[model samples]
Target: MNKNVAIIWGGYSSEIVVSEKSMNGIYSFLDKNRYNVYKVKIDKKGWTAEIEGKEYIVDKNDFSIFFGSAKIEIDFAYITIHGTPGEDGRLQGYFDMLNIPYSSCDWMASALTFNKFVCNNFLKNFGLNVAKSVYLSKDSKYDINAIAEALKFPIFIKPNTGGSSFATTKVKGIDKMQEAIDFAFSEASDVIIESFISGREVTCGCYKTSDHEVVFPITEVITKNEFFDYNAKYMGEVEEITPADLSEEKTLEIQQLTSKIYDLVGAKGIIRADFIISDNTPYLLEVNTTPGMTTTSFIPQQVKAAGLSMTDVLTEIIECEYQKIQKSL
Candidate 1:
């Protein structure tokens, strides 16, 4: 019998609209005969599933079925939400408590990668080159000048745990440093101040299955704006070139680094690592445990370059988790 797959999207995050677009793309490519697919939207009203031309609302607090008389049980949940509840550990924790198998990284990996500061530190201990950064908490003393002195000018200030570059700022000098920190702090309790790495922005994605791990081709991002911020990322303000115009040797090095990161972080399913190639060396920027799945997102572009369709990618992720669960039983 075919498995029941729930593609969850549209969460209470800044990337909610983008999540909707991703869900549409996943739904279009999913093989209907091999699996029963449903789209679940999480909004102010809570989780609601749309299947077989009918809608069923789920309880907001407990996630129990509410609307339809016939209940629905999901064999696996394909998470497509871009930030917050989806990308962070919250939703994954929920599924963990209910013993539900979902695609992407588990709770610890999701939580670790969600916070830029924590993930960078974790990887740094593993011998990876991460940018120098300082973390600021809400209760900490405000020392903008001290931080600037340590990290130097042209620093990147962003919420330590947020995604899609929401409320991220580039402070060119000491004069505008405070404003940037305040802006980032407003969105999150912890803020990360990192020294800027001026180089080509490239991303590499990796897929882990039951048998092996595969790294996709690298993609270079050229943004017209100051950096790949919110607008540049989702609004097509940036140019993405696949098979990143790098020498074959450099490309292989980056792919190897990405594979190492995936193993180091104990990342399962699909994950994307963003990097900055500076001085012929790749510096780890951050990792996306739950990357954007929009048609134009970097992962999809790289997957296409690998000669694999998005459907094939998503199906593999689903089946990998399904097989793992069956083995445990």
Candidate 2:
């Protein structure tokens, strides 16, 4: 019997467009013979499932039935939402309560990684090299001048719980620091001001299964903007070099660190780690619990470098989740 898979996309996020793109990319690659596919979109109207290529709105409170129609059953959920409800653990928590198997990290990991302030501190406590940063809450009172004094010039101000580099600003001098912080605060309740690290930006992805953990080739991201901002990431404005021009020793070191992080976080399925290389030393930037699935995304690029097609990689993730479910039962 073929399993019913629901691919969830779109949500209350800044990366809504990017999520839609990922959904289309995934919808085109999934193996039809192995599963019954259904597309679900989450928007202001709530979650709606596509049946026979026609959308039927679902009740946000109870996801079992389509409005007043008959109940709909799904064996698994594939989340492609890029931010907010998708990456911040809200959707995962909902699925957990329903006892539905889904791809990507669990609730705890998702929640932790979604907030950069929390994740960076968590990793730092584990002896991981991370850039120093100061967190500001929505209701907290802080001295902006004091913060600037502490971090000095050339700091990165960003929303603490945002993705795709949304609401991120690179402040070079003191004059622009407040403006950058204000910009980030406009998008999120919390913000982070991190000490800027001048170095090469790179990323590594890993696939974890019951048998083993496989690390992919590292990719060096070159962006023309001040940094890899939202435009550079999804708009095809940046250049990504797979198997980044690095020595074998440096590559192996990064791969080792990537695998170690996956184990440290107890991450299942697929995860990507972003890093900044300064003076030939790699510093952990952030960990993506649900990495992008677009054809041009880093994960897909690394997948191709591993001699595996996007379909093959995605299928393996689904099958791995299925096997885990079977074992639990």
Candidate 3:
């Protein structure tokens, strides 16, 4: 019997477009002969599963969709939603309650990684290199120049729990710090402030199969549009060099660090680690639980470079999570 799969996309954030693209890439490679795949779009409007150009209501109780005359059950979810209720752990918790398997980290891991400040600091606690940062909430008091004096000039201000570099600003001077912080706050209630790490920007993708972990080749990101901001990541404003132009030593070091962090965070499925190599040390920026599966995304590029099959990768993720649920039962 073919298991029913739901590819969840269209989050309630600016990254909705990216998530939708991710679904498009992942949907085609899900091995249609092995499973019945349904596309689910979740936005501020509602959650609707599209079947044969028809919209159906998805039952929140059991994560099932009403297709025409019958109720369709979802055995697994391939979550690609990039922000808020999706990547921030709300959807994972819902799936956990329903005992439905999903391809990604658990609710706790998802929540922790989504918050950039907390995740970076947590990784730093394990002796990993991470940039110095200041965390702020909606009600917290802060001094603009004081922050500049502490972290020095040229800092990154971004939403604490956001992705795709949405509403992220590279404040090059102390004078623009307040404006950047306010802009980030517009997208999220909390914000993460970090001192700029002047070094090469690189990222690597990794995922666990049934028996062992697989880490893809690293990619170096060089952007002309300030930092690797929204335009640089998505709109072709940057150059991403695969194999990272690094020696074997640095590459292995980074890959090992990424795998180590995955275990420490109890991460599952596919995760990508972004880094800044300063003085030959890889400083962890943040871990992406629901990494973009789009063609232009880093993971897909890395996978292709490694000559790995996307179908196999997605299948392993689906099967591995399913087996975990089975083991628990």
Candidate 3 has a TM-score of 0.98
lDDT of 1 by residue, 83-103 (tens): 778888788989877766798
Q: Best TM-score goes to which candidate?
A: 3
Ranking by lDDT: 3, 1, 2
Query: Regarding lDDT, does 1 or 3 come out ahead?
Result: 3
What lDDT score goes with residue 152 in model 3?
88
- Candidate 3 regions with alpha-carbon error over 4 angstroms: none
- Cα lDDT tens digits for candidate 3, 1-329: 99999999998888898998899989977999999999999899988999998899988778899887899999999999999788989999988988999998889999999988888888888999888899999998998878888998788999998988988998888778888889999999999999899899999999987798899999999998888988888889999999799999999999999999999888989999999999878889999999988877898889889999888888888998898898997
The TM-score of candidate 2 is 0.95
Pick by lDDT: which candidate is best?
Answer: 3
Question: Candidate 2: misplaced stretches above 4 Å?
Answer: 59-62, 65-70
lDDT of 2: 0.85
Error of model 2, residue 187, in angstroms: 1.6
What's the distance in Å from true for residue 244, model 3? 1.5
Better of 2 and 3 by lDDT: 3
Winner by TM-score between candidate 3 and candidate 1:
3
> Residue 31's C-alpha lDDT in candidate 1?
83
